[model samples]
Target: MPPFSLMRCGAYLIPLVNSPLAVAQTTHLPEIEVRGPRDSSIGSADSASEGAAERESFQSRPKLRPGDIVEAVPGVVATQHSGDGKANQYFLRGFNLDHGTDFAVTVDGMPVNMPTHGHGQGFADLNFLTPELVSGVRYRKGPYFADSGDFSLAGSASLDYLSALPAPIVDVSFGSHNFRRLLAAGSRTVADQTWLGAIELEGNDGPWQVPEQLRKANAVLRYSQGSSARGLSLTGMAYQSRWNSTDQVPQRLIDSGEISRFGSMNPTDGGRTRRLSLSGKWFDKGRDGETQISAYAMDYRFDLFSDFTYFLRNPVDGDQFEQTDRRRAFGAQGSRSMPNRIGGLDGLLSVGAQWRGDRIGEVGLYDTVARERLSTLRNDKVSQDLVSIYAQQFVNFSDHWRGYVGWRSDALRYDVQGRALAYGSLNSGKGHDAITSPKLGLAFTVTPQHELYLNAGGGFHSNDVRGATITIDPQSGLPAERVPALVKGRGAELGWRFQPNDDLTATVALWELGLDSELVYVGDAGSTEPGRASRRRGLEATLRWKVVSHWRLEADAALSRGRFRGEAPEGEGDHVDNAVERVFAAGVTYIGGPWTASLRLRYMGPRALDTLNTVRSRATALLNFGARYAVNEHLTLGLDVFNLAGRKGNDIEYFYASCTAGEVASGACGGGIDDRHVHPMEPRSARVSARWTF
Candidate 1:
């Protein structure tokens, strides 16, 4: 039997099990251990937009929230609109991926994106993640990989956790705004098996007229044995959180001094959530092939109170609402890969299958007043099932040319049971949908230091089940048109990578993506909002240079244009709403002896708030600084400053109709007022931490 081998295939690790005699005929082999950070993906990546970041890279940056770790990916940004407990608003390329609509995230082989969620279609909350336990993050952009399926039209990310830590660690942190955190982690070996355990506790009172009293707790445990060639691991995780939310406020009110920038019209808006999961993975290497399998089960609960439009509907009761979701999910995935000859050329063939099912006990929306339910607008139970199969062929066509050709197919089923409503018997139905996607990638190695890549693929994102089978609108008993269960998309990219030496590397890419329809199912309203077909084209570039032995510089930038495909609607234009136009980020780090210091800056360009492009958001820039010093072999001190310049900006903005109490009392709220709703960015803050190792 040959030693186990693994290779990267998109966001997945393809197991290259067996080796030919020509390469494994050695009679004696010496044990080798590799260490140090992987600063570049010169020879391991197939496309310019695909890369992996080690724990050392992101752990050194200043993060305001746990989700900020994702920002380490070039051309990506993560911001918040509500409380810290909620999912972070993500933007990539030119799309505003609200709560991860077109992005897929996974941790330890367990999917994080919840389909048919209560708050959004694909809600992905990362508050449960503990950054210190992360081993690495692998990310890929575009739909040119068969290993990724739904919610991957824009990109996908997978975070891996360490099986064992070098030593026990305890950390304590304190910051402004009443922020505090404590974390502890350790690992022990017994009976040839390793046991790892970690726990975290955090709390914060955000800067708002109505403080966001956020409290959160998280824990993880794992047992593992064997090496990379053959291994088995079982992990369990638990998390719980609660907080008060200060959603976006009207800009007009702030400008008129009727309300402060951090003031909330509804102080009773907040949410509570909890999750428990058990997951296991196993892999084996054999003479003929290799096999990998993983399975997971999860229990989840959520309750949220929100008021996006304060008093727009009911003047006396206010426009507050509550959304609830309780569910259980189970999933399994497996893959097999083997070395095979294709047309007399060396090649590897891989096949994989995935299955997931979600049993939702109750997912509902209700009218509320001051955190109390006034009436049930919609209540239902749902069951969703997904099955996917994919195959890929990787071949070394020649000494300098290689590529992969792959295909994937997915099938979904939805079953909903609804309670009778005041208007009629609506929101109950069964539907099924299936789609097939093809992927192609070609790469040419011009020299040891340069490469060119071309890729194209087909992909799709599933819509909410409620929208697919809706017959009558719950709010107005009027007939409604059913939307497709799944929307299709296509993308292509041309990329180049240059790495003249070990100290410097650069990559550039031109990409385009198109969607059949931009329709979105609004979970808050329990209705589907219609939209026209759309297209996005963009250019992205990234560079990483080790200026000297102790200094490193990194930078990335993107420019994108998005528009509707055809003629505009009566009031809409060609411009895509909330489509980010430009993004630039740069960072420098110095690591020498016992001191490590870093400085980073990020710039986000203005975006259109509406289709007409008359309403736009202001561009903003933010800077952060961090430094750490090793006081001794057993202790370390660190400091981080966020919003170092104290610059004022908006984290998010939307143009919509909302009413105020004064306007309603004066009979001026005929149909509410159309204005810009903005969520201001957090003010300057600092945190200091001390860590002890044993």
Candidate 2:
């Protein structure tokens, strides 16, 4: 009776004592056992917290840039206050996602934020990303799913790249303030088609006292033919950068020593950027079920100079400011998925569409000093458009129940011209908005491993069609009030999941969100201000383990609370300013043989810098370390350590009002006064790397 069959290790199905003609006359076969996912309920919510740096569970993780790869997504928190070519400061759950509104970032399907942005309002910008050609990162947080639209209510991330590459590489790195880097990558397949290439160069001068000197460049090219779920692809990208900034400083000028603590109230504060892109993709999965298509184009540029109120409002050109952006973007998307039954219940159906456009010759705001430009507080020429459509359904009336429903619709258009500047007057505008988002999910499979979830959603974030059509106030011509170009959101979630074997897994969530106004688009006060209407609540937890067979461990934690939905003043206190209350992260990894190691820790808690919370911010922790060694087989060597205990934190903090240089004002000579405004943290750094393969 040596004829048996059934083998599928992961969700269990073992039983194969000998089959396939007794294992083709037996030469060896018998010994298999590797488990996980016995019933991880693949239906709704949770399960998509991924990362890969060539696997082994994140290859000794440690990243200093490339936006730190979204911090591997567990409660995300990336920060940087000035130049690193700008655009990092993220933080999640308790909001404060300023530069990227409520998250949503993508690569490969293109679109990385940037909606009517010149700086602030969904401005994503991962410095064009090279990160060794990524190759995996998928994240999800709130706003259920429905293909997530528009800055996705506090969640979203998708990055994938790597059509080929198993060898052919060169990498070099050196660090500690004078940092330097170079990378080159390759892949090839010739006639059968498959090519990929990459290039990158970087430089840094950091540890500031005025010496940021940044500078970077990157490039990539790709072409593919098939297989990756059936495919065709083409891609190209380029990036450039420059820097010099050390903004954010004033805790009474480092407590009156007048500057230090990585000082710089403006040191010609700086920025410069550029990006170019082209993309294309097509996919098909036969047996009557899947199809996908994508397209993209982009060219962008930005110039920035900031001085977060060093002298409060042009106290003789010291409140420096200048932000300029030029853009051209295009997009397209399509999708389809099928298999259905309805009445008899058994389903799956998906449909999608998306389109986007932006042609902004310039989105400006200036009033600078050492960097030129002396006035001109708003100058624009923007044209924006977006359209979306979606549908989703997934059901399985049994096997422990499952459900999902989705709908999405969005349309937005805005055209603005206005540019006469020197003193206001020269306007032209238009606006239109629409939104419909609905999503629901449910799952219940109480055994086999455990699962339970319920989610609800509706989301939106869009505003700044010149603040939905302003009429004046290009820096005070007065008479300005206009907002609402789509701003609505509501969310809820309750979840739990547990995988009891094959190396553990766990998750838990409880959430709530609401908003209808938080009116943004005040690029340094060029308009739009009127906010209040918010609510948020949260709790999240996660853990993953694989404590043997090479070891691994991870952890996540988050807690939140935000407010602002009614009264304040008298002693203030409605919180919601900078939200963010408690967050924690942990990591551990070790791979034997050729050796690899990792250790990480992060925490950022305590936030509230106004609304009479009497200023708060003091809880930031960091510890990082990484190691790699393999000096044989194609060579390799690596090391990274940052803040490993040098901890003297403060990566961000703000409370406003500035007057520096012996303040005492009644008007002019650096007026306006109130304290705190840090941005320290960076001392104990190291990096060293070398890799080669052919």
Candidate 3:
């Protein structure tokens, strides 16, 4: 039978394959056929912190931006300080992963995090994501898996896109602040092959005093043949966006009535970016073994204008600067798995290898005013390459006991060519590094519905190539010490999973992670910053309960503490700046006939703003609401309300020194003024959308 569309029944959505309203009519519903993600059952999962979210979960949540889709992972929060066209800020565990550093993300077999980027190391931009095409998200915490390599120190998430859709769809939306969007998607089968395509267009003028004026376009085309057991696919994607941004501001400025909370110090602070990619994959599965391989190539460009200090660095130029990056990247990965018998026990062995290279034509930083460059600070052409190999063996010692051990090794090489005359020649160099990590996991099933797990692993994040080879500081033109090419980390987790019944599932985990060094390249400052060793320990809990036939509830909470490992310099303590200490989220959903509604609440606890632990930031909380109604078989409508309570809070905050024009003219800019800089969260707004299916 052809797949039928989803139907709302009470507080949940279920697919209707045979009959409409079949769930309401029967006490024992048909077996659910969720196909994309693997089940994280007692015997199948290695840790309690690992889980998967399917398309249904995505459909039920109310998201404010494309990157919000990753929030499906418990204890992860996605927020933004820049305009809609930029990557969302991600916070997970106890770490504020600025632009996805230490946390890896992927779609299909293509990596999303850009290493050694102009803005920051491991810069991940998901603005091109098309939510409707995502089939599932598989997330793992603590870097315990052998298949994951760079930027997996904190965690990793892999997203899978669907090869076909049940029906063609067209969607349109409009919202407060002149937000508008349109999407069209479809799939067709011919000659035993399926072809899928989608296009999206969006624009928004935010509530900021200076309009965001965001414009974005995205497209995807894919072709696939056969099933998961044996498949071949090719895909192409394109994305482009431009927008003006309201960066963080000093709270004192707002308190003194100098500017509104949602105002920008420099209206020209914004960015434009574009990406084009082509990828292909082939896989085969059989009783003897399984084999999979994939390859991808991309052309990317980025241009950004930002002013963080007003007039601190260059009082005459207003401290505004422009960053430009253009690169061509290519990568390929292949893996094979084989069934085995070890000591008369069932077992499996898997091995994989991956290779990636980036040819950066030019990555530069310059002094600028009103978005026009005045003088170059630094510019370089870079070539970086990486190769990784890993192997894992999984064995079932008994019906209740299972374990796995793995090992991985990675090698990296970098070459830099100077383009600018003043600071480029002295900083350009060549470097190479290598590292190996070991991983192990054990799981014990105490009962049919309960499981205990222990996991420990070593992981690492590569330092920016420029930082690893730097001989001079671009800003000050002084001799600089080069950092190690790779920084190592280790983590351990003890977890429990309890699933008493079909309607209830709960998980709790106690985890700790430590890094050998936190040294990294500071993109904003055009230099490298030294760091100390640090450690973080945390407890996380998640709960999901189906209260009744019409109502469902879910909640997640995390508490963590992070500190430097040893003594600190005078006037500074052990606190890790911007390390989040607490997080909580809860939601309720209601489904009745063709109607569905949901309400969600999120909280972020206060954090230290400086290493001294003297300055701290305030906690923040917000609420959101969403509802959908099926007008007919062909049309459906949706409503989403963000910041439902119109809360006045900040999306992000920092303690820093900056100087305004007035301060500079008055000679008060001496060393700048220390203050709290913040980016206010958006106020209450609503969006209405319509989707048509045929």
Query: Superposing all C-alpha atoms, what RMSD in Å does each candidate have to the true structure?
Result: 8.3, 24.2, 6.4
Query: Higher TM-score: candidate 1 or 3?
Result: 3
Q: Give the per-residue lDDT digits (tens) of candidate 1, residues 1-694.
A: 1111111110121111111211122233223222323544555577888987645667789989999988888888999999999989888989888888888899888989988888887788999999888887888899998889888888988888887666567777889898877777766654446677877778888888888888888889888887768989999999999999999899999999998988998999999999999999999998778999999999999999988888887788988998899999999999999999989998889999999999999888889998998888778788999999999998899878889999999999999888747632566899999999999998888899999999999999888787777787766678878888788899999999999997788999999999887744332352236468999999999988889999889999999998989987797899888888999999999888889898999999999988899999998899999999999987999999999999999999888888989999999888879998889999999999998775
Q: By lDDT, rank the candidates, best first.
A: 3, 1, 2
Please identify which of the two predictions, 2 or 3, would achieve the higher TM-score against the true structure.
3
* Clash tally, candidates in order: 0, 0, 3
lDDT (Cα, 0-100) at 101 in candidate 1: 80
Predicted structure 1: lDDT:
0.84
Deviation (Å) of 9 in candidate 1 = 43
Cα lDDT tens digits, model 3, 612-660, are 8789988989899999999998899999999999999898888889999
Cα lDDT tens digits, model 2, 1-694, are 1111111120121111121211212123222221111213234433333222224444358788788777777888888878898888888898878678889889877978898787777789897798667766767777777888888887887877776665556667788988877776665554445667766777787899899988787878888787546878999999888889897787777877878999887788798889899999898998778989898899999988887766666555566778888989998889898988899987889999999999999888887888898877787888988899999898888988787889999999888887855433445678788999889887887886777878888988887678777767666677777778888888888877777774777778888888877643232342235487788898888787878888888889989888887876576678877778889998888888888888889999889877657789889999889898998987889999987899888888877677754463454344367677888878889999887665
lDDT of candidate 2? Answer: 0.76
User: lDDT of each prediction vs. the true structure?
Assistant: 0.84, 0.76, 0.84
